[model samples]
Target chain A: MTTNHNQIPITYLRPAKGLATLNLKDLWDYRELIYFLTWRDLKVRYKQTVLGFSWVILQPVINMVVFTVLFGQLLKVPTDGIPYPIFSFAALLPWLYFAGSLTRSSTTLVGSANLISKVFFPRMAIPIAGVLSGIVDFVVSLIVLVGMMLFYKIIPTWNLLMLPIFLFLAMLTALGFGLWLSALNVRFRDINHLVPFIIEIWKYATPVIYGATLIPERFRFLLGLNPMTGVVEGFRWAILGSKYVENFDPGPLFIVSITITLVILISGVIFFRNTERTFADII
Target chain B: MTDIAIHVDKLSKKYKLGAMYERQDTLRDFLTSMVRSPFQKRPVSDNQILWALKDISFDIERGSVIGIVGRNGAGKSTLLKVLSRVTDPTSGIGEIRGRVGSLLEVGTGFHPELTGRENIYLNGAILGMKRTEIEKKFDEIVDFSEVAKFIDTPVKRYSSGMYLRLAFAVAAHLEPDILVVDEVLAVGDAEFQRKCLGKMSDVAEQGRTVLFVSHNMSAILRLTTETLVMEKGRIVKRAPSNEAVDFYLSSGFVETGERIWDVDEIPENAAPFSPKALRIINEQGLVVNTIRSTEEMTIEFEYQLDASVTGLRVGFYLMSARGEFIFTTFDTDEPQMYDRFSVREPGLYYSRCKIPADTFNEGRFVVGINASTYRIRRYFQDERAITFNIDPAGAPGMQWPEQRLGPTRPRLNWEIEKK
Candidate 1:
């Protein structure tokens, strides 16, 4: 498999100006590094903990319990007709994944300062791997969601096949914000302190504990502005089926959220690419 | 044209010094700076910009190993970093006609929580090896590290020596067509260092184009045929390794007779003790870099202590130019002196030692100073702080025209009995 020296392709490096071209080919070439880094992130996260992967299951389950007790029991937040527990759990699955991935990926560049400064690879791989590694946790919690559906006597429908599209949308939203924040974190560590606050406020804005139908009819588009709103709403529609919910159609809101997510994702990639060249020096 | 491994055209890298240290990297500071910038009349000046590599242009042919030698801040590391793609230049174009692998440091991506086996794969991939390549070389890497039993154990549990060995082993096995290395041989024990050097020579023998940066003159001379000497962010000399090393050693230190430590040069942790200067003096009492071997000379160290220190002993280590240690002597070597200066008060102090006549050979020697409260804390140390030459004139061996060997020349009294 050895190639001739003359056959090797030449790579030219120059000063980057304005927005750098998305070097997807270079990123593709370093796919193995991304995989290894993702594997490392997954391995190192739960190490030395007695609970290990159980924390993955416990985190969302506990949040669901707290929301159920506070909103379902005390505040009497309406869930249309579906059971409150499953209603919140379905939405919690995607919400927790987005929140978790966003937090991890935002600080990823600063966290891997040694790797960024000492090695040469597609700099985007660091944050992308950060987002990808959260999939393991999402999958683990997904099984718990399935078990909860079974416990609540909810059966699957054809809409369940559409679940991946919404999950991918969640991934895109997390990665978009992650790319922006991670690059910013390299220079101004203020992003590190700002990420948790963003996530906390972001959770309340998205329809995690409450249903989309609870919003006033005229102002629903404002809710759609939050990308995670469509993801959490779509998860409930796909899993719980629209037949169970009262008066919610995710089609229009999904369109708005998808467009906004694309804008953020594309712009975030551009910003990340432009700023990544200086990471080794500044970091 | 096809045989050229690397080529560059007026490559330059400009770094904003203000961004690195002066500008605060917080949102509040950023906002305040924006507001205050409009009110301030001063514009960005030349002092804020550092051209780490200024209009550097060179080419390297395939199957050649080139060495880079320079003093600290001469931009040697910056050049390697830019070539390795670890950082980008301000305005320039550099082309490489082959896959490149750079080891700016050993184990760049090693996670302490990961096992040695896992880290081998991670570090290997980080150094630009594919998974299949790493798998193929897995056994070899493990064997080279000599830590087979601990392969499954986390690296955090491994001793520092084992960690370094494992890290270097993985880096040494990388087989890219162009390899860039920077000061990686400055770590590990002597035996491991020899192994690393051997592995490097093996890589060099394989006909891959290599760029090596090192402060070890001996290693550079042994591994590379050609060398580039850099000064103040420019290539001042390019020649064979022998000539390059000689030029670097002779002119690298701007001040040869005496070395003064600047306030910024000393680290913050060395507070309560600050070194002022280190000097070599001949019998005539003038600071000099070249001394006659037969004359008695003195080595003096000036320092200050902000706070009283107990058990503080200041000393200097005498070493050969080849980095071999001749001896280490402390000021409080005598029993009476140790008892009297057991607790040195806060004040300026000078520690001086006189070398008897006929001590050194006709060659260059280096002096390094150390200040410490034995076993408690090490205040400061500079291993190759200053170097000087000893001339062989007027020595016992002056009668012979041929050169003498070794780092020392001791005069021994001899008599012939008429038996």
Candidate 2:
């Protein structure tokens, strides 16, 4: 059945001859969906609970207290003359956001199996929303961090404005890793058990509870290899200022962090694009 | 735009039959396969692949309501899936010239925990509607769904009928250039189904391309301009709606004792099950569709399982030719029989049951096969599978020319008493 009706645009579906299809334009078209899903996740997150949104602040606050007790009192880990609570809270702000985003984003595809199979949208949107939703929790916890910094009387300087930029880096890091994990999780379920363990091990490698000075100067350069190192130090510099940054070079660490994050994120996008086509069949 | 709204060029999809569970794309799977390579003898081709769509090609015009009809597993869903881009084709191309809206399932993104109001936006976004577009259609969608009162309530609290109504309402208002609907109207009560049919007809009349796949023959006859019959992954025939339904229904009924299913007659949805033959046997064990009513006869259904499926109970329902009430029985209906074949292996199996003498009236009876795992699940059921006539030559009723009312014609002992 054929007729000459010159109205609708032609869309061709065929075997795409390529290693991957980024389809960034399609992603751009469906950008509103990403916003709504992220909003939905944030709205539903704290519903019908006694503590409700307090859980957001309570998680990092409680973690900061535990680290102060163990690392500060028991192990006596140096904080480079900065108060341990503020130091830990400052670093924990970005660290918890990274961890939370990583956990949620990695499972976003698996969680929405019905949507993936039944609807057509950029598959990347689901995981991106997972990372975006955590920003709300991060913003809430940052307020609590500000309150704690006031208690210690260590005022933030010009570096305070760069907190969101560092937070964006953390988001990119989570998304970079999450893109790989979410796409991989669609086929291999082993990623589910592997993520929590990765977060646990990853937290200590960064200077969340302790200061960067705890690691020897000889091995200090190696610490920058961990992407979170720059994020944590970036957060510290932004909130606590360089006086507490302990002569650490923010320039080189920032460059290393941005470079590595970009590489991982771009590669993650390519990998996700490669495997997304078969998600419905496997899922 | 092209003259053809949609052009399908040699569209095909190949799926590995039994290895679906073992389908692995991870490094662990690769490592295991490499580790066992030296010890293994079976080649990769040993994993049999079923071509769900095999070089099928067609062209659909703009603003035409086309219906796809076939027995289950005739690759109808696969065709829709390929067109909707749910899964990519193995080797083919389909040029769809329009903003296509496919309703593969109602409530594609409805979260049970979310309120109906929230779900409208969520489901709309998933359906490719922008925020501004949904905001504009918000009132229209709410009014159409008839859930305006409970739009604030969580959808999990709504009755399933209400949920489906809301879902269908959102989908109805899509107004895409081309609409692909697959059995979505089968939900809800008769009245709602009628409303959906009316709405679908309105959609077709509005000069939008539509591809509808349904088993409801009457609906197909009502709304579709033309129909395509799919059998075993290929379009076997295409004609106007009425004639196509006639050919589709009549092709299943044969005038002989043994009905041998041809390749095209076997449905595509009958995956893992390829029916071989269905036979009617007399007391002496000879196949016969027409048998003496006073003698016992057995009906046997033969099929082969391409993959091993668990808890499969293959049987049939014996009904009258005019589609009256009848008994439904499965192979695993008996206690011991259920245990014996609880886990079915990949092989040929025959389910045969004997019916007592004088069980049917002097007319034709239909045998509808049911293949499922009891109430837990149902795989396939062909209600009008085959028909056979009973010749009551020497029965008690043969002396008189009276027509019986019900399905059974029995010779019960009764004596006339002086009142």
Candidate 3:
């Protein structure tokens, strides 16, 4: 066995300093762990509940109903001539996925304190798993959106291909903020209290309940800075098609949102990597 | 170079004391500190920094089994944590030449909500085993745990013994070029413990380097050839297991004749009954670490009470070097004395017991002190508090050149009635 020592890989451990590389190869090597952990999160999510998977669909549908009543009926909020139920329900799918992934990812590090402190793996897998586990919920809720689309007699178009792209964008945005908040949550438990509040305020800022046209033309760029603005608007555009909504273009808004998301994500990975060494000690 | 499995060079780790309290772990406290920093004149003190491991260097060859022995807080766990990469060292470097599997704890990532089968995979992955590897060894692991029937049941529903066995079984199957283990044997029953030991010996037989840390002297002596004795934050002695265990058992305390309790060493719950010191006095009335087997010796315990304690008994347990209990004696063992001192007053007191002449054989003896109110509360206990050696030259066995077997050699009258 000693004769084949050259074939064995060596790992040198030293203190991390300054900015560390993202080490994506390490993440690639542990891809199976990411899968197992994501599987675990999905399996354990609704195990004992009576409603089980129904809660996934009910959450968005119930929110869509309340928004339709408040904005569509009494307030008479415009949906660009698209039916209020289908319009808002389309946006709600991505928004709820983003919110759910964000909340779960931010708490992932603290929640898996045992794994972090006891074992060595790519720490990034934890939050990534957190973001990935929400996809089942997103896909399940998308079925309800399809049912609503059928009810509204909306025909599928080439724009339907863009749904996955926008959903991926939503996942990236959640992962970006999730990495940042989860790493911070280890040292400052205040992040635990702060995440839900952020989600609550972030929902009203995005165009989930109403159309993006509600934002005045001049301040639309400000809306685009919220990252999810583009994702939600893009989801509506992709599913409802350009003909359903009036003069709604996701071009400039996507540029702004994608740029912000990439910046957050790249920097979030850097910050998380730098602080990863101290997590076991502090957490 | 190929033979060296691990090379640790001047590695050290420093931890800030009261880290959670001193560092702002909350946003409110952090922001407040940030706002107040400009006006604050004093910097943080250096005394709060503790070097858990200091400038330690060692090299272990492949296929060698090494043991680490130390008292609690002596950096045994810290060293293992650093080598296993659970935490980073403050300075220097450690190079490993092969895949490392560390068992700092058993079933580290086991989830109560997951079935035992699910946990095996999760825990195996967490311990650095591949999924296919786990799948291949799945049947062997389940058989080892003896929980095949309950493999699908959530681990929370399993009995505690079954839980521990399954956890250890998964850990036992971890095949890595180098293995790092802590006090995992401290759990499980005696029979299960023997099985774990057997499995570990098998791992050792496969020519893998093993770093084992345990307080069980017998386990260390049996499994390891070379042992490292640690004190404070550095390796003070590295020798064969016999010499290392002897040195550790004899000089591990603050001093040989007496042990003075430090304020930090005493837990807050000890409360009203605070121990001051424990001492061993000889016939000449001098504190000593060695005495003749024929000479009577006194074991004294001094403590102070802030409030009166009812039914308080102060006693000491005498054990041989192998941790076998010889006997336990209390200051109030006599019924008359128990009645008189049933209620210990709020003041300092000394409780002493004498071992009669010809009581002990020629070997090292350990004394452990305990103070408790019967069936109510245990004030304090310091097991292995102090150790002393006995010389059999002056005892009844001096005429025979052969050593006596057993912990004690008593002088008893024998009559030749058979003839």
Please name the candidate that would achieve the greatest lDDT relative to the true structure.
1
Clashing pairs in 3: none
How should the candidates be ordered by TM-score, best one leading?
Answer: 1, 3, 2
Q: Which stretches of candidate 1 lie over 4 Å from their true place?
A: A1-6, B37-42, B261-278, B281-286, B291-319, B322-359, B368-384, B392-402, B410-419
lDDT (10s digit) by residue, model 2, range B277-383? 88999989988778888999999999999999888988887877544446878888888988888788999988889888988888877787778764444566666
TM-score of chain B of each: 0.82, 0.69, 0.75
* Candidate 3 per-residue lDDT over residues A1-283, each given as its tens digit: 3387679889887976777778899889988898889998998898889998899989999998998999889999888788888888888899999999999899978988877877778899999999999999998888887888888888888989988989999999999999999999999999999999999999999988877888888887898898899999988888888665567677898999999999999999999999998898888
Give Cα distance to truth, residue B69, candidate 3, Å.
0.8
Please say which candidate is ahead in DockQ: 2 or 3.
Answer: 2
lDDT: worst 10-residue window of model 3 chain B = B16-25
Q: What's the lDDT for residue A129 in model 2?
A: 96
TM-score for each candidate, following the candidate numbering: 0.89, 0.82, 0.85
lDDT of 3: 0.86
Best by TM-score: 1
- Error in Å for residue B120 of model 3: 0.3
lDDT of 1: 0.87
lDDT of 2: 0.83
Question: Which model, 2 or 3, shows the larger lDDT?
Answer: 3
Model 3 segments beyond 4 Å from truth? B20-23, B38-42, B256-319, B323-362, B365-404, B407-419
